[model samples]
Target chain A: MTTQPVTLRRRRLHEIVSPLTIPLVTLLLFVLILLLAPASLPKLVTGIILPGLTLAALYFLIAAGLSLIFGLMDVLNFAHGSLFMVGAYIAWSCNVGLDPLYPNHWPVTIANSNARFVIGLLVGTLLGAGLGAVVEVLLIRPLYKRPIYQVLLTLGLVFVFDALVRSVPAWGSDSKAPIKPSLLAGSLEILGRRFPTYSLFLIVLGLTLAVAVALLLRRSRIGMTIRAGVQDSTMVEALGINVRRVFTGVFALGAGLAALGGAAAASFIGVYPEMGLEYQLFAFIVVVIGGLGSYSGAAIGALLIGLARTFSDHLVLELGLPTAIASASTVLVMAVVLLLKPGGVFGAKE
Target chain B: MPINGRRTFQIAQSGIGYVPEHRAIFRDLTVLENLTLAERKRGDLRRSGDLIFGLFPRLHERLQQQGGTLSGGEQQMLAIARALVPDNRLLLIDEPSEGLAPVIIEQMMAAIQQLSAYTTVLLVEQNFRMASAISQRYYIVDDGRTVHTGAMAALRDNKPLVQTYLGAA
Candidate 1:
């Protein structure tokens, strides 16, 4: 009888502790940071917050699509990063007529104007979306029944796409920064902190897209189909929805989003041939930390990792630690989250 | 007719409700959304609500709950409820009593029997008792081929055939 009471108490304790793991760890991390570097508070608000949100926004842009595509199709698209790289290269070409493959070839004075820049962004996003659609139809469609083949095909595409970009005479292996539009080139003062205007634009764009996607999933018929498809796709087909077509649409949507994220990232950090791998690595981490197939998990995971990385960077600087700690912080957080909640905060329990 | 080839949705659009085996309800969606998604014709949606609620009153209480969170019995109700929401001319129910407590199975069998009054029910079941209780005609297939065909009452009289094909029930 006494043992039963103890068992009940232990179960109660677990019920309470399990839900608080992430928040409690987050609080403890903040307390430790404050104690270790008390002098960095102003910098935290002034420097870290906007940039942290901007980074989070960029992470969300890539991770959201990754989460959806994985959730619905069960395909791990390794080419996502390469798609982002291709998008940046294409957008760059549109801005300045460097690549013969794009609209403004060299000696075409139609390049470098603000109108051209706007046109570049539009063309870049649309073409990225279009390329994603084509890839789905031509390559992904045939391999739906063979999951291993899908993985191999996407992994192969990563190398092929990277090599294809490098082969373009205009793109090459060098890094090129796209000039920011005049509207986004300036900086804004927030709470006496001057922040780049472009970063704020990214923050707004990411937030807007997140809401839009969430609303689409929650409210639309297509969204219903996706949610159902994720659970049991064959049943969805039996229900009379064109599930094959939905698969293609979702793959294209995910690729397009990743490409747009690449175009946006081009302005923040100059576009290099290898940039896609860097962002893709982080995008994978964000997806894992968020829960593999959960959209809200992706958004929350992005915010957590974004802030954690930014704060760690500041800590490294303030404490004179090696710069590698900043890079390692996100992985550490992921490890902790996985240890506590193996399925992720929002992922379905295994 | 050849049923218009492989596109299942087109066949569904022609007003056929399918309750596949294993209660294939979307685990992620709410009970209401499950019903809402099956609504092919908006004009007849009001009738759907009345029919489903009338058949399985327990679902009305769990409208907001996710399908996966429900008990197996409840999930089966949601599956049957989902197929019935649209204005379907025929309902093809597959093994509603596959995995259920005797009590739940009785309730499900009763619900299916009640629904047969509203639409054509083509039930495929291995349970001889359930198959005989709810159906008029009977077709017993062995190894992907029909071994016998007769009325349910006639099949009940054939003790040897029941023992050979269906086993003692």
Candidate 2:
């Protein structure tokens, strides 16, 4: 009897300890280093933590939309990242070129940072939605039963869009300009450390949008259909819900959100051709880590990746590790997470 | 069988409740969301509310819970409830007692019987006893084609036919 209790206790301990070991050990190591070698630590955390968080938030924004589309439609939208890039360009052109083209009717405020931000967001969303709808009608609608064909077609679209964007340099002359709003131009002191106000704004915006998304998914009727459609789309169709429209709406919503993220990031990172690729890779990692079709998991995964990248940068510099080696820490961490939980942190196992 | 145009519209307008042979609950959505989405209402929340909760009381109780977390019986009930929600004039329910306990099957039957008061149901049941109990009319689908169509009473009374066709004593 005593032996059985001891064995049971050991089994329970193993269950608790095995899953938590890596995070706990990593946390302890970080804390110990902070306590003992505070001076050796790099300024990257202080300098880049906020920006890293902002980037992660941007990733979450884009991925949330993509995840929703994948969950509901079971289609991998390879053109999603391309759609995001297009949004940034649209915003840039709308604020700069379009204003000049239609000067008499154009609002003078389009030149300003705040107005450009609003215009960019609107234009990006609409353009993305329109593009998605058109693509669905032309390409995706026909390939509903053929998933492999859908993926290949979308992948082909990415290259086509990339070429189109590269050819359209004349659309926006001020592509290099970083349009930070005047309200968020200044720095603020936090714990005797100065932080950019724009970073703070980005963080606030990302979190606010995340919360709004959660509420919408839980409360709204359309949101309910989206949630259901993710599981069994055929049943939704059979119920006389006009599932084709739902698919179009979901695809558009996802593409729009990606565009919004791209537009927002363009204000900070500047409009560059490869900007979407950088975010796409990170967002894909976040989605994998969070689990497929789980909103809460995505949020948690984003925060985790954000903090990990920040901390890893600090650790590498502080430890005098090779810059390239240190830079690959995020990938290493993601690999480890996958090895530990194959289905991801919150994903359901088949 | 050639379905007439009028029958097609009737099936389309009055929702077709399809309880999948496999797990079809949206793995991401809550029980209430599944039920609500199944309704497919334009803007009438009251109609959806009355139909969904009225059919399955358990769904009302576990509205916030994820559909994936429910028991087999509850999932079955949720599937049925989802079909019945949208003021569906006709309901098509797949096997309802496939993996349910005796008590749960009884409860399921009661719910289906109650549903018959408001909606015309076309139940595809493997359980001959259960099918005979609830159906006013019966259609035996063999090899994806209808082989028998008659009143439930006629089918029940013909013991030899039941034995030969349904493998039921």
Native contacts matched by each model: 0.68, 0.55
DockQ of 1: 0.48
- Local accuracy of candidate 2 as per-residue lDDT tens digits, A137-231: 88998897799999999889988887788787464323467666566778887655778887787788789888887777667877666666665
- Regions of candidate 1 where Cα sits further than 4 Å from its true position: A1-20, A97-117, B1-15, B42-44
Candidate 1 structure quality by residue, lDDT tens digits, B2-116: 2547477778777788998988888668888788878776645577788889889999999988776799999999989888888788888888888889999999999998988
Model 2: CA > 4 A from native:
A1-45, A98-111, A171-177, B1-11, B22-30, B42-60
Spell out the clash pairs found in candidate 1.
A240-B9
The candidate that achieves the highest DockQ relative to the unseen native structure: 1
State the weakest 10-residue window (summed lDDT) of model 2 chain A.
A1-10
- Cα shift from native, residue A234, model 1 (Å): 1.4
* Tens-place lDDT digits, model 2, residues B54-136: 76778889987867678988888888776666666777777888888989998889888987888788887888998789889
